[model samples]
Target: MIGARVRQFRTARGLTMSELADRAGVAKSYLSAIERDLQTNPSIQFIEKIANVLDVDINALLKDEAATNSSDETAALDEEWQKLIAEAMESGVSKEEFKDFLEYNKWKLKQK
Candidate 1:
């Protein structure tokens, strides 16, 4: 739930509910209600304020746990691919050279 995610991040950052509410410029009681799931629907403006104070994207707070986990896994894979590309660039692999390699690999797969 959005509330749970919010609480998770807030606690992880060692922020008390009052502190988070104060930083987000929201009412402390309203924030408590949100964290406790007594209030489930918060306005986008409300979410934006909390998200900003938490330093997290609004999507992170809104996504389901499963979707968030998948997104996290995908992000890790993307980071790995980015590092590999950086290594290739550092090794002086030109864009044209990489394009040729891709074309050749495609053709080789077609031949099989």
Candidate 2:
């Protein structure tokens, strides 16, 4: 199931298995095994790498397609927000720090 989802997203993005593997820093053979369902239960970190490269939410890769649909506008907005959050996470910004920043921003907006 996860393998099919990975393949679907990868193809949808016009990325070959080799390209996806290279970009995600994953072994191509491992990625192939994943797509072929020879390897189930990939680590979260591996999924995260693929999701980052695919510019998709992790849930999209984990959940069934029927359950993942939304308005195009919402999907686009969510994709952008996911990218931003991923960037913050990669830069070592803790969730608490992100919440603090959001709270600060809310307070600043209230002052206007």
lDDT of each: 0.82, 0.85
Residue 86 in model 1: shift from native, Å?
Answer: 28
- Cα lDDT tens digits, model 1, 1-112, are 7888788767656678989999999999998899899999999999999999877789978886545455777755744664566567658998999999999999999999
The estimated TM-scores of all candidates read 0.59, 0.59
Candidate 2, residue 79: Cα displacement in angstroms equals 16
**Alpha-carbon error at 64 in model 1, in Å?**
2.0
Per-residue error (Å), model 2, residue 17 = 0.5
Off by more than 4 A, model 1? 66-112
Off by over 4 Å in 2: 67-112
- Show pairs that collide, candidate 2: none
